[model samples]
Target: MERRTDRVMPPRYLASVNKVIVGLHRLGVPLPMQALTVPGRKSGVLRSTPVTPYEVDGRRYVVAGYAKSDWAKNARAAGRGELTRGRHRERVRLVALPVEERGRILREFPARVPRGVTMFLKAGTVANASPEAFAAAADRCAVFRIEPLD
Candidate 1:
């Protein structure tokens, strides 16, 4: 099977996607979700990325392909941010984990990922992502445990 490096989204489309996520979050719709907000590691500007979350044992988590992404870096620097789901918003602390722990959690990914997403993670798809690749990405990307402070 052939593996392709993950592709980056164009800046314009990325911005539009972000806007839609923020809009949906403000609407209070109950959908599996995640908001990656990171403070610029160097400049300190806050950066946020919206993602579809995989829920495990009632906790929400995200698997990223690149750890150095702006949002991941920001979360590492700031250590926390706002998590909005539909109409609910909560302040959350960021938690970065070791590869072993992350791997354990992600091992169940096939089950946790929504059925519609299986195609992407399939053997040859963009997400045909190997365990090592996933681990490497997780190592770089901050894994946040969004505990609600309400």
Candidate 2:
């Protein structure tokens, strides 16, 4: 598989990560999954990404580390998406949270960090720091909460 290594780390990485997590989930280990798919704000192409999800009160969300990235911009333009995990898929609407809510979610992320995620976290790939530092870094990301359509 050709992996993307751009300094900006485009949406392709998200898809790669999803393949790994979905594989793991299929093996009976459930990891939080977030999919970011949007119609191009300008070009009209459909772009999608898989992300590590943060959950609250049965709802799922994703933190966009690079807020200005194309995925984020596309999401803002599309406003809605399809989120899938295992056999469960739902139509969802995206909502940007207030900074206070984002901070709270970030602070609570360590509890959800998967056990096998230490290597990546420790290597500074994904908020690999003390909980406080991780939260701080997460705060810099664009936080979006998803509302599933019943």
Candidate 3:
């Protein structure tokens, strides 16, 4: 597979697909998605996007396949956000994991949330969908631990 060396941006076509997903989510379809809402770094207004979270051990995490995408930047700057899945909502602290700590969590992505691998693969975020590939891509992406503030 060809690897994209440049920064990844969501494909323009995803805008339409995301709307359908968002509509399904609003209708209470149980997809493995969360609407992550964080304050914009410059604008302060809430910015929301759909993310699929995966788990390692008992902890849940979200990954930024695009590395420096706006949502990732906002989550890093704001340090917290709201995760909404259907009618379930939770306030959470977004703890950016150190590079060294991200490999294990990332290695689980392909197995835990297999469907999400396509995004990373298409973005060239990983060399391949293998666990080892994802582990190696840790430094190229951002991993955040989602700590619920119930």
Clashes of each: 8, 1, 0
In order of TM-score, best first, we have 3, 1, 2
Please say which candidate is ahead in TM-score: 2 or 3.
3
TM-score of each: 0.65, 0.65, 0.89
Q: Score each candidate by Cα lDDT.
A: 0.57, 0.61, 0.85
Q: Write the per-residue lDDT of candidate 1 for residues 1-150, one digit (tens) a residue.
A: 445445433334556867777666656665566555556778877666676556667886665534555676677677777766666666777666666577655554555664423433442224444444444333433355555556
lDDT of 3 at 142: 90
Lowest lDDT block of 10, candidate 1: 116-125
Q: Which candidate ranks first by lDDT, i.e. highest?
A: 3
- TM value for model 3: 0.89
Error at 146, model 2, angstroms: 0.8
- Give each prediction's root-mean-square deviation over alpha carbons: 4.4, 6.6, 1.9
Q: TM-score for model 2? A: 0.65
Q: Judging by lDDT, tell me the better candidate of 2 and 3.
A: 3
Put the candidates in lDDT order, highest first.
3, 2, 1
lDDT of 2 by residue, 74-145 (tens): 777777776656556678887877666776666556677454245334334354545565455543456788
Model 3 spans > 4 angstroms off:
1-6, 26-29
